[model samples]
Target: MNSLTIALDVMGGDKGPHITINAAILAINKEPRLHLFLCGDKSIITKYLLEHHIREHPQLTIIPTTETVAMDEKPSSALRNKRDSSMRKALDLVEQGKAQACVSAGNTGALFAMAYCVLKTLPGVERPALISALPTHKENKNVFMLDLGANVFCEANILYQFGLMGSVIAEQVDGITKPRVALLNMGEEDIKGSDHIKLAATKLSANKYINYVGFIEGNDIFTNKTDVIVCDGFVGNVALKTCEGVAQLVYRKLDRFLSEHFFARIIGKMLAPALKKLFKSMNPDQYNGASLIGLRGIVVKSHGNASAKAFEAAIFEAIKEVEQQVPEKITIALEQGLIEETHTE
Candidate 1:
């Protein structure tokens, strides 16, 4: 098997090196082909590795960084001031070809800024978008959503590009042939939504390479009705956070109701195993990583408050993208789509 190198911004997340170091250890152990460069303060990372007794493991390497990007740091501040930060160095590794991909649970804005500044976008990509898979209604099936807070707003052309990007992810990463693509809007009607959205829809529908399914409302996101859902960062971010909130509410309400009475508690105990499995499927932690697509290199962003297991999932997410050559695929798709558009015009 071919070995893969990934860089982790150990000091960028909420729990700092504590969570990322453990996740690195977990990833290296589970995937023998993985070699991780832990980018952060050497002293802190050394302490964690010592605690785990794998300080000198061949699969692990430390890339000492003097600074760390704070969770609340502004994008401009981080980009201009934190050059040697753990987050910046991790991205640098990818840019330098020392690592095929990088994963971080850091400031979203800062990471995006550093990544864009460092790796730049593929030839035809204007801006990168955050994308990740979500569990759908069908068993063992998932749907991909894009623009999860990568940009505040996008024009019609950008949104049209997002649909193309999302379709490639669904087809190449998820192995869905000619995946159905939809625009997330207020209504499914052709005349609804802003003019840009309508324009994007018209462009998508006309693309023979894309299987455009028209617009879908928020309620249908998890219904497996569409393989790819494209929207601006504002709406996608809100929809993602809303799903997380609703999942937590459901678990809390179910647990409280089950423990309210003696008979109910007994029933809960009886259903504990199944209930645990159900909640596990719904947990946002399992889906912690969101890939920033359209860049020259691969980057997977973990949730800020991700636990060790959650962050480990992010590392593996990067690994998958590396193996899949996602950036190359996106470039080809965009280039082909652009040529087609030019001919039509």
Candidate 2:
């Protein structure tokens, strides 16, 4: 139980204080040395803390913040106007060294803005990208995709940096000594994609730091063809949401089909366990949450619709990141000039 304090934005997300508070409790229970600084309405947190009989844990602290950055608020305006918001307060904690990391299910854009503005980025990092792990069928192998709505328009060099940063995360977390990297394109051929990707492919292929695996189509994302997939934020976000929508549709269709007939219903019951396991494996919440890589400290963004379990998982994910010293490792890699230009024929 390492003494790692995480500042949590309690007022953020659809679930608000209820799910966030409960998840904090769950994290504290799991790790005794974990201290949580809940930033939100103090009264709300106090009421739940007393009701849950979690009194005087020494590890739990509540910071009073009255305002909250709404999900729909403009990131720039929110950051400029709401100085006392819970999200900003959480980032302040990280900057002040009071917390090792910050966790939020709040406004994605606002969170990213606050992180960059407060904590800043490491040297050689042009922009801090949002990286998340998606479930894959390969055993002990999960796929990582980055620029997930962080930088909508990225340069060729930026995409190459995403690959390098993502590869470091995969190797550290998944134990992949030499993680395979790929450029996300419409086709696998060399002459596919735009000028951005064409230039990126050249740079990634020429760089010796990462194991470049040429180009990968959107369909190959889950086929274990590559360990890390790099693309601009706009494209990556679209791919992520599309996969999520398709998964939900498949589940709904299966449910409807199974109940259409008595025999099918019986078979569904018999196969429920396996199906549940498969679904669980594919769910995004089970893997790493969105990490604000390239920043000085750890900052994780959970799904706005995340449940108590998902929040708990995000806390542990942050813990693993701190324990692994990801930021330090990346800083070393950057200093060594491991991120270089690559060219593909």
The segments of candidate 2 whose C-alpha lies over 4 angstroms from its true place after superposition are 285-288, 338-345
- lDDT (CA) per prediction: 0.90, 0.86
For each predicted model, how many residue pairs clash, with residues at least 3 apart or on different chains? 0, 4
Model 1, 186-231: lDDT tens per residue? 9989889999999999898888778999999999998999999999
lDDT of 2 by residue, 1-345 (tens): 558899999988878889889999999998988999999988888888888897667878899998989999999998899899999999999899999988998889999988999999988788999988886768767899988888889999888778888888998988888899998999999888899899988887787777999999988989998899999989988898888778778888998999998999999999889776666555564334689899999999888978888888888888989889898888876665453432222
Best model per TM-score: 1
